[model samples]
Target chain A: MENLKKELKEKIIEALNLEDLTPEDIKDDELLFGEGLELDSIDALELIIILDKDYGIKLDDPKKGKKIFESIETMANYINENRSK
Target chain B: MKSEITHYCQIKNGKVIFDENLLYEDKEVDFQKFIKNAYQFFELDYRKFYKMDPLCKLAVMNSSVLIANLTEKLDPKTALLLTNKSACVDIDLKHQKSITEGFARPADFVYTLPNISLGEISIKNKLRSENSFFIFETFNPEFLITYTQQLIQTKKANAVLAGWVEIAENDYNALLFLVEKKKGIALKKENLLNLI
Candidate 1:
């Protein structure tokens, strides 16, 4: 779980280009959207692509992303359970 | 038709010049690093800036400098007329490579058209009057002058953001002017040529 969270944080930073941030800067429970990281819809799309390309977790419906991408913890937990790659 | 050059921004050779004054310059940096430094210097927090290809990033950076100090809100009647030689060829080549490798990314695919930079500017500034992007073999000041004149004379726009934004290979330059019916030098082809 700890390793998955760290990798997820790194992936988010690289894929969404949180250029000024590092993995340590992102708290596991911090919100990914709105006030926390201030990510927008486009960042969400990039995260979806990251999940598919890096983890082989395909999300056909974007709405599911709201829950899975709520925070680094959520994304790491979801990917650990479902990642094909 | 009478119009004035209210404001302008020129980015070239790792330097950003606004209204003829040198704002930032760093010749040693790579293209991406230079752009990132300029964006940081401007203190711009627009997150979507990262997603833009080099051409769009250049356009947005230039326009952001041009409109930074306006006391009044931008007129919705503002039109954008931008010209470029390469016309998103840089991003197009990247997208083509992605397709050949069987891993085409949609984000890259969206910027295949050069005018998408105009869309980015309009969305950021909320200017909805008129906008067009043209491709020229070389910088053509006469056409820009003529088109800007027509837009002002026809009362189609109260202001026109017109300029040349060229990105070829690793080299890039953006020269943009805000044309309006206000106090400034007359918008002339010679003046535009001299600035570029």
Candidate 2:
């Protein structure tokens, strides 16, 4: 779970172009959408692709991703539970 | 009072970036290679202009290079004067294709507006100054010189990036100069040809 959290943080930084940030800067329990990283709708699209490509989870609705991707903790939990492959 | 071209650079496909003194007879650009280099150089990995809008791409390419070369930072008061011949023709074609086809990409529609390229540059650089886009069959030195001088005289801008940026279905030519009321030589609007 901790390794997944670290990997998720790196993916978020790369996919969203958080250029000023390093993977170690992101906290596992910090909010992903707003205060923690200041991500937006476009970041959400990128996260959807990360879910599909890495975890084999296809989110049909981006809104559902809000609950699934609220924080690094929430995301790792969801992916561990629902990953198809 | 008049502004001068302190520094400038222009480049065609696979050529060394140079200024106006270096004559470039070759007008051909490897569109595929140019597009690829531009994407890599600018880090614009997004799906914008993937269908090959040469004009839009030219704007992005030149602005990227220019910004990279600029020694000074741009602000809201910086005036941007963009001159182009074919303004968003590629976008127009895409819009027509969408009408004929079942689905029109909404993103293409957004780029169809005539001044979109200019707006894109301004947004990319966060420049909020007086920006203008002009269309002409060829370079009008008289108007170009006059307008640039007047903008500075009127205090609309501290610096002006003025030039002819012409692109077609597959070709592009950019003549760019950074003008400011600083430690640069001054020339009358009528003497532009001689100065160039």
Candidate 3:
């Protein structure tokens, strides 16, 4: 789980072009939108692609993504349990 | 009312010139790195810049300097007139390649339109004004002068942000100017051409 979280942070930074941030800058429980990382709907779409393409996790329902992508912790936990790859 | 070109920004090669004053220059790096440097040198607070396509990035950066130098707040009705030779072709080609390879990203799909650059500038500046983009064989300062006059005279807009931004592989030329009804260099063909 710890390794998955670290890898997720790196992927997020590269995929989102968060040029000013490093893996250390993001906390496990930090919100991905609004305040912490300030991501938006577009970024949410990009994250969905990452999950589908990289982790083999197809998120069919967009509403469930809100809870699944709440933080690095939630994403890592969800991916750990659901990722087929 | 006679519109005048108040201020202008030019980004050519790897240098940034505003109102005919050199503000930033880095001749050593490529275009992508040059934009990143320009973003930092200008001290822009907008983080969404990183997510933009290259054309939009250049447009936003060029307009931002003029916006920052405004002596007074921008009138909400200020219009935008953007003319470019190579409208978003840089991203269009990349997106085409990504699709041919079977891995097109949504981000790339969203920026396929040239007007998205104007949209990005509007969103960044928080200006809810009329905006238009035109394609031309080259920079057309004459059109800007006439259109600016029409908008100001008709009260459709108080000011106009007119620009010509062209970006291609290993080459880029961007010039953005603010036009007002009065109080700057007279918006004449000679004066506008001199900046280019």
Candidate of highest TM-score: 3
Which 10 consecutive positions of candidate 1 chain A have the poorest summed lDDT? A11-20
Candidate 2 stretches greater than 4 Å from native: A1-85, B13-28, B41-52, B185-196
| Reference-based lDDT, residue A29, model 1 | 97
Residue B30's lDDT within candidate 1 is: 72
DockQ values for all predictions?
A: 0.38, 0.06, 0.68
The i-RMS of every model, in angstroms, reads 2.3, 9.0, 1.1
Off by over 4 Å in 1: A61-63, B70-73
In the range B66-179, model 3's lDDT, one tens digit per residue, is: 788778887788999999888899889988997898668777778899899999999988889989999999888889888888888888899999879888865888888888
Arrange candidates by TM-score, highest first: which order?
A: 3, 1, 2
lDDT: worst 10-residue window of model 1 chain B:
B66-75
Query: lDDT tens digits, residues B1-196, model 1?
Result: 4689988889999889988799889874577788888899899888788878889999999988888856676688999999989999888998899889866777788889999999999999988878999999999999999999899898889899999999976688899998988988778878888888
Candidate 2 lDDT tens digits, A1-85:
8888888888877655464478888887888877766675656766777787778998987677878888899999999998986
Docking class of 1: acceptable
Superposition error at B58 for model 3 (Å):
0.7
> What part of the reference interface contacts, as a 0 to 1 fraction, does candidate 3 reproduce?
0.50
Give the alpha-carbon lDDT of every model: 0.88, 0.68, 0.88
Model 3: per-residue Cα lDDT over A5-50, one tens digit each: 9999999998888987899999999999879899988789889988
Clashing pairs in 1: none
